[model samples]
Target: MTDQVEERVLSIFREKFHKPEVTIDSSFAELGIDSLDTIEALFEIEEEFGISIPDDAARSLNTFREVVAGVEKLLAEQRIANPPAAAGPDAAEEGR
Candidate 1:
């Protein structure tokens, strides 16, 4: 799941900047992406992953790893907020 998140996010930035060399360790400044670009990429990320990032949190994303971490954090919070429902007929038995 973490790999999925990182790949998706790295793709987003790469597409945004047309920089195929963008890696998890790449920093926004190093990539010549300013805050505006970061915010736009954040919008793309929110739409892609179905998550919301607050302005304060969005502003703190200075590196690609940070962006991935923030997205992971949001995803974790989402899982905690809305867990999957049990599906099997044995679900109740398992709970016991």
Candidate 2:
């Protein structure tokens, strides 16, 4: 899940900042990403993940890892009730 989110985020950054070399550990400043661009990319991330990151939390993200971690945390919290079910007949039966 983290990998998936990271990939999506990287894609967003690539398109937003025109920096295809961005990596998981890349800091926004290191990638030449300004606050405005970061905010725009964060908006894109929210749209892609269907999650709302509070203003304070959004402001706190400085690196790719932070963004991915924040998204994963939000996703985990959101999925608490609808935790992913395993595949197969046994898993379905357990739900019942």
Candidate 3:
């Protein structure tokens, strides 16, 4: 899942800034992407992953990895709150 997140994010950077070499560890400021580009990237990320990043938290992210970690953390919390349905032969026994 982390790999998927990294790939999707890298694609966003490449598409938005036309910088295919931009990597996951690359600093946003050092990537040469302007403020508007960063905003657009954030919007794309939120929409793509269906997650909301508060302004304060968003401001703290300096690399694509940070954003991915944030998204993963949110997803982990969500999963714990609403776990998946049980299955398999032991399902009923486990429920008891």
Candidate 4:
């Protein structure tokens, strides 16, 4: 999951900032990303992942790796809050 999210994040960085060389270790300062760009990128990420990132966490994400970790954490929390329902045989047995 982390790997997938990391890939998505890298893609976002490349598309949003027009920087193909961006990596997980790259900081916002290093990429010449400003506050507005960060906000725009966050919006894109939220839309892509269907998750809302809090302002505090969003602002604190200085590095690409931090963003990936934040996204992963949000996804985990979302899963815990809304776990998937039983399916197939298990669901049928439960309904019996």
The numbered model that scores best in lDDT is 1
Query: 1-96, model 1: which lDDT tens digit per residue?
Result: 999999999999998899999999999998899989999999999999999999999887899999999999999999777765574445656877
Those runs of model 1 whose alpha carbons end farther than 4 Å from true positions after fitting are 87-96
Per-prediction TM-score, please? 0.88, 0.82, 0.79, 0.89
Q: Residue-pair clashes per candidate, as listed?
A: 0, 0, 0, 0
RMSD values, in order shown: 3.1, 3.3, 3.4, 2.3
Model 4 segments beyond 4 Å from truth? 87-93
Per-residue accuracy of model 2 over 25-91 as CA lDDT, tens digit each:
8999987888888899989988998899999998898999999999998998877745567754566
Report the lDDT of model 4 for residue 64. Answer: 92
lDDT (0 to 1) per candidate:
0.91, 0.87, 0.80, 0.89
Q: What would the per-residue lDDT of candidate 3 be over residues 33-66, giving only the tens digit for each residue?
A: 7666777898898888877778888778888888
lDDT of 4 by residue, 6-40 (tens): 99988998987789999889999988999899999
TM-score of 4: 0.89
Model 2 poorest 10 in a row by lDDT:
81-90
Off by over 4 Å in 3: 85-96
The candidate that achieves the highest TM-score relative to the unseen native structure = 4
lDDT of residue 49 for candidate 3: 84
